[model samples]
Target: MTKKLRNAPAYIFLTIFAVFSVFPLYFMMVSATNTSQEVLGSKLLPGTNLLENFNNLVAQQDLGSALYHSAVNAILTTVLSLIFCSFAGYGFEIYHSKGKDRLMAVLLLAMMIPFAATMIPLFQLFAQNGLINSTAAVILPTISTPFLILLFRQASRNFPHEILEAARLDGLSEIAIFARIYLPTMRATYAAAAVITFMAAWNNFLWPKVILVDSAYQTMPMLISNFSSGYVTDYGALMLAVLIASLPAMVIFLVLQRAFAEGITGAIK
Candidate 1:
């Protein structure tokens, strides 16, 4: 009874914070269900115009194509990032060559440099390669992020060395050991990386906006930007689009949330 009383305040605080966090999303859904005029009127209750709002959004914007582009960017970037980042992380952890530590320190420092500084150079390189206004351009540069590499490296340190030595003694090649052993053991870390990479790629705006010149190649963030830039904005349509755009990220988070927690704990443990 005494312990429950002591913990009551913390639970109350958490409950309040959770409500505060969820209210905006709840209001967004309510606004999405209303007409533009109704949304502007500041009504808190849900209305019955969701279908109409969505239809208007579809009719006005190239939303379908934008969704396709976003999907491709997110999925491709996530998969490729996981592969290369994990490989680099594993190699850095296991190999330990001379000067490799210095190189890694430099890479970590590179992550601190603002991405805006590198944009012009990246654009020039992509343009030279005829990748301007292409989905490949969006996906290529994000394949090896420093942060994900760090995550994998931390997780790799916890990997069982006894198992690795056993595999080596059994005539397993390094690549085979990595594929059959390390990858499976780090499933939680990989799932966490997948969620993070997908969200970053999906919500990426500034780089995609600068690189993708053609409206046909625009992603969901670009579409939302177009909607909000107009003089007379359609709040209902905008809200609906936001709700739809957020769903994939939410779904990914929900699916991998448990693994994400496990991954973090496993790395630090």
Candidate 2:
């Protein structure tokens, strides 16, 4: 009981923080169900206009297309990042040499530099490569995130090196060892990386906005932005778009959360 009392403050702080995080989601749901007028009327309660808002949002010019592009970009980015980051991380960790260690240091340093400083150069490079105004432009830069590599490296540290030796005893080559042994054995690490990578790709805004100039290439985030403008912004429609944009990520997290939670635990053994 005395120990529990000592931890009471931590529990209180966590409860407060949880409420703070949840309030906005509640607010968004309520706001999405009401009209711009009702929202401005300062009602935080849900209304019956949810269906109407959905209709209006879907009715927005090229909304379905925008949502499709955003979904596609996110899926492609996450998939590629998982494959590349996982391989690179496992390789760098399991196959350490002075040269590769220096290369890893370079990659870590690159993560320190803000993408904003490189935006112009990145855009120019994409243009030069004929990738601008395409999904490739949006995905190419994001698919190789340094942050994801670090995450995988940390998880890989938990793997048993003896497992590698055992696999080698079975006459497995380096590539075969990773594919048949390491990858299959590290499901949790993959899950955690996938969740983070998927969320990052889905929520990315600046690069998508910069390169995807046309409505065909625009995402749900851009759609929400356009909806938030001018004399009479449809708060309900805007909220719906925001709501829609958040769903894919939510679904992903909810579905994979168990795997994500377990992934790190398994890796440590």
- How high is the lDDT of residue 262 in model 2? 88
For candidate 2, write residues 236-258 as lDDT tens digits: 88887888889999999999999
**Model 1 misplaced stretches (Cα beyond 4 Å):** none
lDDT of 1 by residue, 90-140 (tens): 988887676878888988999999999999999999999999988889999
- Model 2 sits at a Cα RMSD from the real structure of 2.3
Tell how far residue 224 is off in model 2, in angstroms.
1.0
Among residues 3 or more apart in sequence or in different chains, the pairs in candidate 1 whose N, CA or C atoms overlap within 3 Å are none
Candidate 2: where are CA atoms >4 Å away? 1-13, 264-269
Measured with C-alpha atoms, the lDDT of residue 73 in candidate 2 is 89
